[model samples]
Target: MDLQQMRYVVAVAETASFTRAAEACHVVQSALSHQVARLEKELGARLFERTSRRVRLTTAGEAFLPAARQALEAAERARAEVAAATGEIRGRLTVGSIPTVAAVDLPSVIRTYRRRYPQVRFSLRAGSSERLVEQVRDGALDAAFLGVQPGFLPQGVRDREIGQGRHVAVMAPDHPLAARHEVDLRLMAGEVFVDFADGSAARAQSDQAFAALGLRREVAFEVSGVELMLRMVRQALGIALLPGAFGAELHGLRCVPITDGPVRVERLVWSRFPPTPAAAAFLALLDV
Candidate 1:
């Protein structure tokens, strides 16, 4: 009947065990059971069918689930509204970022964001740009820092390009080309290459560059994360092509210019749901 009881029922249904649900809710099992029973009596319908082996949501419970979650979310927003009215910006903002950006750019930005607005809470999740875009679209995140992949954003999500850095070729220090400050793309012919997967933004751009030069190299490996690919390069698996930020930390690897082709640009992008005031502030910092 109340928010607390509704939360208890939702937790029980999600975990399918009262004991597990109680643990998740940080309450005793008996209290959780009592609250759900009271809620069922108020509704005059069984919310869940509990057998000794398992617990399953009944039709009534399934119908009520979404409304219950929406109610909780609305309550939280109302609380946030009151808090904001008091000049206190306090709420959780979930953000997603690709691994390369997470390692290179996020720490300083996160530190600044927290220092500027100590009352605002942040939950950062790191993943591939493709996966991060999906999270932003589904409203799992308030915003995300994604690599600027073509056709990545869906409607209602806004993406802003902030800054761009150059890409470099990463190779093991013992490699023959390591002594060179720059290597021509034609010199890389017949070499084993490590790069992003096909259809990825970086891969597509690299493909176009290679095509323009009429150069072809054997792909030794394809990976989703630039950081991982760079590490593979360091281990002497193959040479990697990635944003400069990825090679900045490697001591045993050499980053060289890939002459005879277009220079790759690593784009910084941010994707948002309906923008929040706090998120706007963060984006403003990015703009500056």
Candidate 2:
């Protein structure tokens, strides 16, 4: 069987639907099915069990899946290596980010990369740090800027850090303790807290800090994005501890440094997979 057939098998197995796999592969369903059938015939064993509702991998299919994935990755690495050797990098680079990054200083770096590698394409998606880590580990993303607690990242994943920013207390300007230049966790202990959702990287850091101080938070709101959390803070819904990066645009809110709060860290993380030519080129630009 060919690489296309292997790709078809992998896609079909992943999606569990011929139609969905065909759509993902940008091919008609009939052609995809025909190719899979031909592959099975040549192999002398069925790879999938199809029903009206869903498709599943047969035992042989399960056995063959890993090799198929390896073959595809190998082919990808080969293509990337050749492109790098030729000094021409042109491909889609899917990157993920958290909402708070919009407030961080990043425009110049992005603009410089764009100017240097005009041929490289970029696709950015916003998601929770936990989800972004999952995507990077699964090879669905080239890399992502993620908030992670120290020593908490999964095995085989590597990170390039963007400093551990000082944590600050965010709240309405008129809220109690807002007039202070700095606040400690002990002072905010009695107030309602608005925080990142459970299992998020930011939450992990906050939780570790609270646990260290032997304090428990009365989380009034748990949100997915920094914007919503800030909105809540502005309305006096609760106080939140966020990184100083958010200090730039307070809008109707105040961000006071938490003298002893958790350090907020962001990292650019990538999978153990060999980088694509475009991803490598982009990474090279980061060194500047």
Candidate 3:
């Protein structure tokens, strides 16, 4: 019923642990748990299923978190609007990005934004593109920088294409294809490959390229984190196809361009609705 109670629920839902949520909200664990329990009693539904291992949202919590988040965001927007009307732009900007976005110079962007609006605070969250997109849609994140393919964007979200690059192959120096500047897809068909998880945009593009060539990939490992895949490739477990700008120029490995595949575009994505003042300001600088 209260904003604090709603915030408590959201924090628990996000962190999946009462102790961690209490830490995030800067409250004592006992008080946070008491408030959430009171709210559940008022609503007459179990919000979370708690186990010794983790907390999971029940059906009711899943149905309620989005609207609660929107209410919180709307309250923030109202406060920001009043402050902005006084010619002072100050508020929190929640931003999400993928690990591969290290190539996008986000740190420089944040530094520049801070110089312009020192009153604004930023909280940066890192995750996969899929998780970022989900957060943006639910208003848990104000905006995000994502790696996506053209025309596959999530609904109710807008994106600006900032820059783009393509996938490349990396292998040990002693690998047969190391001497070559580029490697053909067919040449590596027989080799065990390290690749992204099937749900990732990078994996989708790689899959399409293989399907087009009528070749089936021999996936030895499918990992969610590209860093782990790079490590696997470096250790000679298997070759990997990764973004050309992944910033992993292994001295012991040769990086080569994939002869065919769709280009990976880096986009600045946000909800289509009005955003927080800090997020708006940061987004404005994205085009500059």
Q: Report the number of the highest-TM-score candidate.
A: 1
In TM-score terms, candidate 2 sits at 0.80
TM-score of 3: 0.80
lDDT of 2 by residue, 173-223 (tens): 899798898888888888998998887677888888888989987987898
Overall lDDT per candidate, in order of appearance:
0.73, 0.81, 0.83
TM-score of 1: 0.81
Instruction: Report the Cα RMSD per candidate.
Output: 3.4, 3.3, 3.7
| lDDT order of candidates, top first | 3, 2, 1
- For candidate 1, write residues 1-288 as lDDT tens digits: 799998998798889999899999999999999999998998999999999999989999999888898787667667767777788766767888766662236789889999988888788887766677677777667777765533333454676554445556789989988899887777876679888888875676567667888878788799877667877887888887666665576677898877654443333444444455566667777772
- Pairs that collide in candidate 3 are none
Candidates ranked, most accurate by TM-score first: 1, 2, 3
How much is 204 displaced in model 1, in angstroms?
3.0
Q: After superposition, how far is residue 117 of candidate 1 from its true place, in Å?
A: 2.4
